[model samples]
Target: MTDHSYEFTRAITRRPGQSITRGLRAVDTGAPDLDLMLAHHADYVATLREAGATVTELPPLEDFPDALFVEDTALCLPEGAVLMRPGAPSRLGEVAHMAPVLRDLYADVRVIEGPGFIEGGDILTTGREVLVGRSARTDAAGVAELATILKDWGRPLREVATPPGVLHFKTDCSLLDGETVLSTERLAASGCFEGYRVILTADGEEAAANAIRFNRFVLMAAGFPATAERLRRAGYEVREIGNSECAKLDGGMSCLSLRL
Candidate 1:
């Protein structure tokens, strides 16, 4: 898999903890219901398997409320995995919890040392180059460190600013294919994705920007009918999944797992 094209064969995910309601969120979206969240997670796992991934569902971590959103802890690459230094102190321990597991799966697992902060949510792979979003969650120092760590891959690191009000870059955009990205009008206008084709989400369907391109399907949040229809018309096999609970906490489809 190049930066943009990911034919994921395996995935690593963690179930939401019972304390998930206490997880951090920029908005006070209502607290998540544990049972409902679990059901959603189960369906997410099913979706991944349907898209050809061998899923490894880790047991829920009771101590970490936001542990279910595991993608923020690390990034899986074709060459190796980079364990990120989370921006939130409450989330820092998550990397420690995930490192051993990643070490077992990846021959080489690199770490991002602080006073820098980085999160997988701020990173976007475009096959030829890696787009690192310098948002409040990810800083220039973190980007520089990641660039150094990824130098062996020889892909230029493209830096982009996260659009205002977006918690992460992918919260408003995701790569649909090697050359095309599905984004909200706000993100498309940001000019962060220069040199690539940007497909604006259907009006009022900004949440669709966070959709994921699983092996053979575009997995997106449910309830965005217009956006879903647009993707279908674009020749994608889009699968709509319920994510109301996660949405309440600012979590999106791509935040739930580490796909590689």
Candidate 2:
């Protein structure tokens, strides 16, 4: 099946710095508290470890307000790592910082050098193929470039559309297993996951859609009880982490780490 997307042996996470209070947001909900964010981040990393992953925790990058959202920096696959070209200008330097780290681990690391832009958060690699959403942070050219890269690894890339106003594709969906997906109704309604089993987030608990299925646990943002219970009932080991501060910055479970 060639699927390592959900079952990961390791993960990379960065601590949230004081500058995270100034992180980018679609709407200014409120400023994130560094203390609260750090606490939540710790829980997130610990949960990943508990799920049987060797988590590499990196120090905070104060200069990059959104650096804690490491999932946007690169796509970690069984084949190798693909460094992303973020659409956000301020986030470009983040890739440079992550490059060395990934190079140390992967012998075949590739970069997206282009007039186009793509972020790892916009990508979803299922068992059968890789799906990429063209969102505000990911363009057609970037998707094309990524497709070309994946082709060499004998992977298929399918271009999809991110729901309007979403920060990234994963902000509305996640792979649950080889053939199932947990997604917001709005995104599933788009017919993007046609052949896969789709579990829609409980109505009004849409934010819960941005969850991740790590090795043996489904890590989700705290506060969405309905969605959490829904997943539990569906036979997933659910772990809820405090995400109040990260939520304030439009960040969620999947944004905190890059699993490989």
Candidate 3:
């Protein structure tokens, strides 16, 4: 079997004012603090490169400071990539910006154009199957459309409800490996994700919930000291990087880039 390791790259959000105007407003108002967050994103890009993965810095989309917008709108697979239709109307342009980048990496690239909207952040795929979180940001039409595309590649797709109050599917639950899953008690208790072996966090740290696995390594946010330590003790080599800026924009390590 072929190893499915991945590298990640992210575009830094330069003009917060321009990006914020297009989507939901930032909850935090400190301008100086927000600048620091942007700096942290720069550090994140560097960390990925140091880990021996190829890293590319895509130029910021003119006028779309939210152009780091890549995470909300696309998914990369071994064969090709699926361009997502962002649920947020303002974020639709994100797909156009992401297509060329993906094409440069894979030749069989395709898209999920709509009639339906999907956010890449809500989708997760493993060796067994591809799973999508049915949330406000990802609709039924989008899920059905994606299922059709995956079928062509011989990959099965499954859907799980990301009920109200949860961030996203992977945000609450993530596959740690083929047989183990790292999820919060809140999601596991809801009886929504019933089949996977559950590993719960001692305290409620939603930020720690979103993680990206590349080969044998997992990338996580540096700020969550307790949560990071816990995962480290579990025999997983975790790479912690700062993501304060992305967090201000409601983003996480997994949301900053697509790994494939």
Among these predictions, the greatest TM-score belongs to 2
Range of the 10 consecutive residues with the lowest summed lDDT in candidate 3? 7-16
Error of 2 at 146 (Å): 0.4
Q: How does each model score on TM-score?
A: 0.97, 0.98, 0.86
RMSD values for the candidates in order, in angstroms, are 1.3, 1.0, 3.1
Best candidate according to lDDT: 2
How well does model 2 score by local distance difference test? 0.91
lDDT of 3 by residue, 122-181 (tens): 886765778798987899999999999989888889887885765567767666666566
User: Distance from true position, residue 96, model 2, in Å?
Assistant: 0.5
- Per-residue accuracy of model 1 over 151-216 as CA lDDT, tens digit each: 976767888889877899999988788888999999888787778877789988898899888878
lDDT score at residue 178, model 1, on the 0-100 scale: 83
Give the C-alpha lDDT of model 3: 0.69
Whichever of 2 and 3 has more TM-score, that candidate is: 2
Summing lDDT over every window of 10 consecutive residues in candidate 1, give the lowest-scoring window.
1-10
Backbone clash tally (model 1):
2
Q: State the C-alpha lDDT per candidate.
A: 0.88, 0.91, 0.69
User: What ranges in model 2 sit over 4 Å off?
Assistant: 1-3
